[model samples]
Target chain A: MTMIQIRDVNKRYDDGFHALKNINLEFRQGEMTVLIGPSGCGKSTTMRLVNRLVSPTSGTVEIGGRDIRSIDPVELRRSIGYVIQSVGLFPHMTIGRNVAVVPRLKRWDADKTARRVDELLDMVGLKPDLYRDRYPSELSGGQQQRVGVVRALAADPDIILMDEPFSALDPLSREQLQEDVARLQQELHKTIVFVTHDMDEALKIADRIVLMKDGEVVQSDTPDRMLRRPANDFVRTFIGQKRLEAGGAADVAEREAGPDLGGFVMADGPTVNDVMVTQPAVTYPGRGLAEAITTMERRKVDSLYVVDRQRKLLGSVSIYNVMDSYGDEDKTVADVMMPVRYSVQSGTPLTQAVELLASHRLHNVAVIDEDSRFIGLITRGSVVRHLAEKLPHGDNGEEPGSSTGLGPQGGNREEHS
Target chain B: MSAGLSFFEFLGERLPDLLLALREHLTLSLIAVLIGSAISLPLGVLLVYSRIGWLNSAVFFLANLLQTIPSLALLAILIPLMGIGARPAVLALLLYSIMPVLRNTYEGFRSVDPHVLEAARGLGYSAAQRLLRVQLPLAVPYIMSGIRLTTVYVISWATLATLVGAGGLGQLIVSGMGVNQPYLIVAGALGAIALALAADLLLGWLESALGRRFGLRGGAAA
Candidate 1:
């Protein structure tokens, strides 16, 4: 079913801010689409338009084939589940009562209200017996967010709007909540429009990521394609900006690849990210051990980049982690993979082969610089030998440092702290 | 003048030694104000919470009617039935004090969130339960304001009972003025002011404490 469709939706505030211009997009049923952009982007305003919290200055918003303008706003809002950073809980009501709000307003009978509240709390992993009667003030931030989600789910709405629902939480809590949302999506299957300024967050939960800026959409595509290629330079700039610190690069991998990355990024020259698959797609550590074996067979590639949702490159999964974590359901992605090694720069001299092998125990390193934005990889067997035959090893032929700038020692660290 | 302290002493001595007269005056003030508040609180809640046309109209009518009449004039109209003494005085005080309490009470209840009430509505609370469970608890601050205003008015009007032969502090003022003793008249006036001020402070404290207890629903704004 076409859950929501926007065609040339342009909103210009009376104050003369072009909040959104010529917006066109379609959201299908039971899919998770993330809208991401910089701070002043119209993503938040766009989501608010769906619920009519903020009306479009000049555009038609249709929900399930009905122009939202024709339907009563109160009724429309009631039919859709809305969640924001604050959660907007009624402070006076009990946890159970809050979750039961929409259903009760819609007049779900007594026994049914009780049953729905009970099931929802449980689905969100909050035991009804422990939390149903407690007040919003009594819960923690993550728990409050969970209840907020439960409240939206109470009516079993076909569409859900979530705006930075986890940004306020700590990293561990955010990961936990994201997992909860992923679990919920699998079970209830609501068509969700999630908004966030963080690209890593978009990669984690989005089936399709829609990049927005200045109230206009720049690109919309799946995580795999977005990483493999980017539609434009602005997206490419955001594609690999560090998040959590120099941890493992799992999350950054998805981000490092742009929305345009469906094919390979060939660095023979400077090609825009949209034209090629710049970097290889990284698999998650927790994915079945069978993933490594299957990807190897399907893509006919010997290795796959391993990453977390942030798009940071954790490390590459070769025949290595598959053999190690094989039969170990208990084994995580981090457990079997080596820390990042065999990395290089995009501009290493075509020489120094003998020195490269002796210094870094790896066959290759990247031939790139600090930004790592468009660095080309250099194989020890290729570039070093070429450079050795021609230039002198002294002051010039590629700065004497390891081919992989930081060396195979610690090349690609985590983006976030 | 003993900073005007002697005025009080002089008036206290001049008033009659009749214990029954003083007690009757105080009793009349209490009875009238109490009855008035009892009727107003419920009526105010209904007007604000239920949005019932008759209830709101009744509140508006009583408040406007009482404010228009002079206190002494209103009492005269009741003089035919209860024959002077405490009866007419009590009726006059009750009628005069109702408007403020009624208006504030109604406002307090009406201002609560429709969403909070919707939660109650969703929970399947009966009409009466919705009022008791949601509106009343949140309306306490406004209700308290009405109560405070009624207390201040009733205390001042207690002396008006003297005109009906109920014999309160006003009896001393009347006697002192006739004999040319300004001290007795001043004393009675000072006592009424002190009583009103005290009632106002006590109720204000009570309302604050009540607000603290029910502050969970964005209470500072309440």
Candidate 2:
């Protein structure tokens, strides 16, 4: 269902600057539509037009099939949730009161408003009892932003307009909040129209990305389609494919494996978990050199990572070193094995994992959990395969099969070469 | 002294007259401030939001000019039109006190954080609602400061009412000076000073109380 419909919108400011030129768009219910562009690209102006913050110079904005201008602007805004870059939590009001503003304005009963405030604060991961009476100044930036989101959602408004809500936060807080928003959207499925200039943010959270430039939309498509099939040079340059390839490959590849992964892309780069091969060839420390070499040959890997009976990593014995003691049945693999210094946590981002491998000039690294138990191995070949799948070959020529089988392979790693 | 008494003796002897005069003096100041606040506050609010920039400036200029006129001269000037009594004296003081209340009211409403105002507007507050809930509350400190200044100024200047035949503490001073009685003059001067100080302290307390109620930074600075 169409939640918001903007038709033939044109906005000309008092200074004669054209802020929006014939914008025509429809935002669907239960989907997060992100309006993204460089500064002064009319994305903000477009968002403002929906809520009547800036009435279009010559067009109509409709929500739920009724023209927005026909409704009282004040009433329209009261029923539509709004969040800004500043978070805009009323500094003078306590968190509970701030979240209860709309409810109070709507004349809700005291008990109901109190219950709703608590419900919203809890929904956003803030303990209501702890944060309810605190002022906005008392909370940190991330906490304030969380309250800001809850305040917007307090009234259960059908359409929410967010204007760079997380831009002011630190990178770590921003990532965590982006996840929170994604998670919240999954549970609530409210129609959200978000305005942001950060491409990665748009790609992470948007169900449909509306790319704008110079007061007009250049392209509006899913993130996968936008990445693979840019409409023009402007969009291609704006997305910066070359810049992405140089440093943002893991981020691109992480999403590449699941184009339809709905909300925020979790990892900044692909994690070791994303590329690691579970059930890597292993040999017991008590095994002979020939026995270890035979297992390596069967798995077609160059080395055998030796483990104790509990599967904790002890060391690794490569085929090259095992050959020196080929005929010695008395010598166990542990005697020939070299201590493995290069290991990464399963959650370590693939970029850092690659760095560790490259610096040590190693072909593979053991993937371990916090308990030092070996789970898998991340190989250079797997990294290359993941990245190659994201590279644009031509317009709309995406290899749809490449990542189809990559989805949560379920307790076993099948050889796909 | 004319009555054959010391300054303290004169104060004791004229205690009844002094009390009557002090009451009249306070009555005149309070009436003038009340009238001035009632008239100027709404006008100040209207002027700030109104688009008639020239009219606002002209009204402000006239009030500023009124404030600069010598208080006695203005009371004297009003004497002919309104008769020489408390009526003309109150009128003059009202004119004198208008500017501070008006100017500060304008400044208070104007100085409300634009972002806060924007948030209010965006959240669908009507013009009246915004003024009453957001602007008025935030402007309390400034408005109270303005009223405090006006009250103190009016109380001190009420002595000039004697020139218009409106008897106050100034009667003793005028009569004492006429007969060259220094003690009576000292008594009157002290009474007026004490009244001014008392009024100032009282208004200051009110201002801070209002500030604290509105949560405007504990109200001390304002």
Candidate 3:
């Protein structure tokens, strides 16, 4: 059953501007639909119309097959959850009360409301006991956003409208919140209408994406279809062809290799990140060389990536480097570690990564996120394994001339590292 | 000059009368402020939500117009209508208090964060719910500051009621001026000033307490 149906909707402001042209769309039950475009593209206006915050100038909007204009708007909104980018928690209320606003308005008893507040907070990974009594000012930006999401979810509304809820957060926080949203959709199966201008965010979160431009939807399709076939030049630029190409190439590879390859296709091609080890042995910069050696020994690795508590990449120390500093009583790992100059983000293509590693004669490159936090590492071995897996029928298993460019001794030494 | 009494001796002798006048002055000031607040706060809320700029401007214009008249002039103007007593005196102070309280309430409503208001609206808040749950709580700091300012002004202006035989501390000044007793005049002037200062300090504490409850940093400072 369709959760929301908008037919022939047109909105014109009193200032003689058409905010939305004749739009006809249907939102399916239990799906995440993202409305995305640049500013003034009517995404938010469309969302507002569904909640009856703004009535359409012409045409009709129906929620659950009932005309929204016919129903009381306040009652209609009570059954719909709404979240925004600003995370507008009432400063005067405690976190618990902020989450319980709608429940209280709906006249739920105090005991039930309190229980629901705690349950929702715990679901979002915030400890209810520690956070419920605190004010909004006491929370970090991300924590407040978590509370905002839980507040919207408090009433267990079947439909939710989110307008760029994570846009105000830092990249890491935004990514985490995006994951939380994805998890919520998976677990609850609620009908969600999300509006954002970020194409990547739409691709990551949307079950179906509605690409808009200048108050008109250019195309509406699944993420895979949108990436494969853009309806127009505007959408093509909006999705950024380079990113599509990267995703498209991997997808094509997936198709040709059949479903047998399945998850391995993403790892075998496209980005160097495809072949990276996400949980490489990590040590802090202030540790003693003895400690670094022990960590490497425990992890069964020759080198340890050094990072601060925030996971900021400092450098790395290999077994050979630590051995060179043997018998040093007071020397910390920072004293023995080689400065890490070669690192790659997860988006770097496999070919570029291979060239970088070959040119620099490096055994590995640390993978860091935009914030320079160590995420993983792409090694010479993983790249070789991915290449080996990509070959159609190279099952002869002749060792593939270990180290494609390095000599025999060089190959063995690289293998040892 | 012929009266051989020191300032301390005069204060000691006139302390009881001075206390009675202070009590009268305080009663009149408090009553005016309480009544002014009761009238202005709701009016301010209505003006803010009315969404008619012209009506809001007209209301503000009339309130401000009343404020521009001198307090003595207002008292003189009210005497004929209310007839020389605490009614005329309290009514004049009430008119003077309206400007600060009403203006502050309007400003407080206007100054509420638009984003927070939008969030409240989006989350299914009815008009009354939004006003009570979000707007009023957030605007309390600004509103309290306005009430504090009004209370201080009312206390200061209450002394002027002596002109109409209302019998506040201002009577000492009037009688001293007539009889040429400088100590009586100084005692009455200082007492009125002290009352105003004391009301301000007390209201300031109340404002900050309200602010602290609402997590606002500058409630008392305003």
Tell me the fnat of candidate 3.
0.67
What does candidate 1 score in Cα RMSD to the true structure?
14.5
Task: Give residue B156's lDDT in candidate 1 (0 to 100).
Answer: 78
Query: What is candidate 1's lDDT per residue for A101-120, written digit by digit as tens?
Result: 78877888989999999999
lDDT of 2 by residue, B115-208 (tens): 6776677676788988898888777777878888998889888888899988888887898899988877887888889988998898888877
Q: List TM-scores for all candidates, in order.
A: 0.55, 0.75, 0.75
What's the C-alpha lDDT at position A262 in model 3?
47
Once superposed on the true structure, which residue ranges of model 3 sit more than 4 Å away at CA?
A241-417, B1-9, B219-221
Q: Following a full C-alpha superposition, what root-mean-square deviation does model 2 have from the true structure? A: 13.7
Off by more than 4 A, model 2:
A241-417, B1-6, B219-222
Worst 10-residue stretch by lDDT in candidate 3 chain A? A407-416
Candidate 3 per-residue lDDT, tens place, A182-249, comes to: 99899999999999987667867899999887788888988755654567667656654222222234
Q: Give stretches of model 1 more than 4 Å off.
A: A241-417, B1-222
Encode model 1's per-residue lDDT on B78-113: one tens digit a residue. Answer: 788778877678777887777877787778777777
Model 1 — interface RMS deviation?
Answer: 6.7
Which candidate tops DockQ? 3
